[model samples]
Target: MESTLQIMPVQRTSRNFGEYAEEAVIIEEPIIKQKRPLFIEANTIEASLEHLRNDCIIPVFAKDNEATLSHVAFIEVVQDAT
Candidate 1:
């Protein structure tokens, strides 16, 4: 079986509070946006890195999405322990 690498986007938010002079203080809350996991073909650890570099997997995964490779996390490699 071929190995697979799982990558997901990370979200971040900023808070804006009105000045003390302002009558109404605006309190913003942090919002976290999640995206679907992206799977890549990786038969081994080295192959995984090669795919990420040669294939430019970052943009491929970020295409038409706000997420970026920097936000990618939970990189999992599924292999048969035989």
Candidate 2:
């Protein structure tokens, strides 16, 4: 199994000059799919994301298990200003 989670760094503007700031990471974990730590160990998170994007099939608890949906979701990356 593979997870479709992506932990990206959050970028923010410093109150100061032209310098850029990087805060905490924001994860965009897949809503329709989940994987365990073993899967993460088998492949890096990045590899897992790529594989999930291509080969993973998302299960649908909706439609009384009679249907499946192509789940592609994203979330905004944010962090504390401080």
| Residue-wise C-alpha lDDT for candidate 2, range 1-82, written one tens digit per residue | 9979899999996687435666769999778765556865778555344566578777767758764544333211222232
Q: Candidate 1: lDDT of 33?
A: 81
Report how far off residue 73 is in candidate 2 (Å): 2.5
Tens digits of per-residue lDDT for model 1 on 1-82? 9999989887877656544455768999898787744554333244454465566445434466765543123243223222
What candidate 1 gets wrong by more than 4 Å, as runs, is 1-48, 59-64, 70-82
Residue pairs clashing in model 2 are none
Error of 2 at 65 (Å): 4.3
Error of 1 at 50 (Å): 3.1
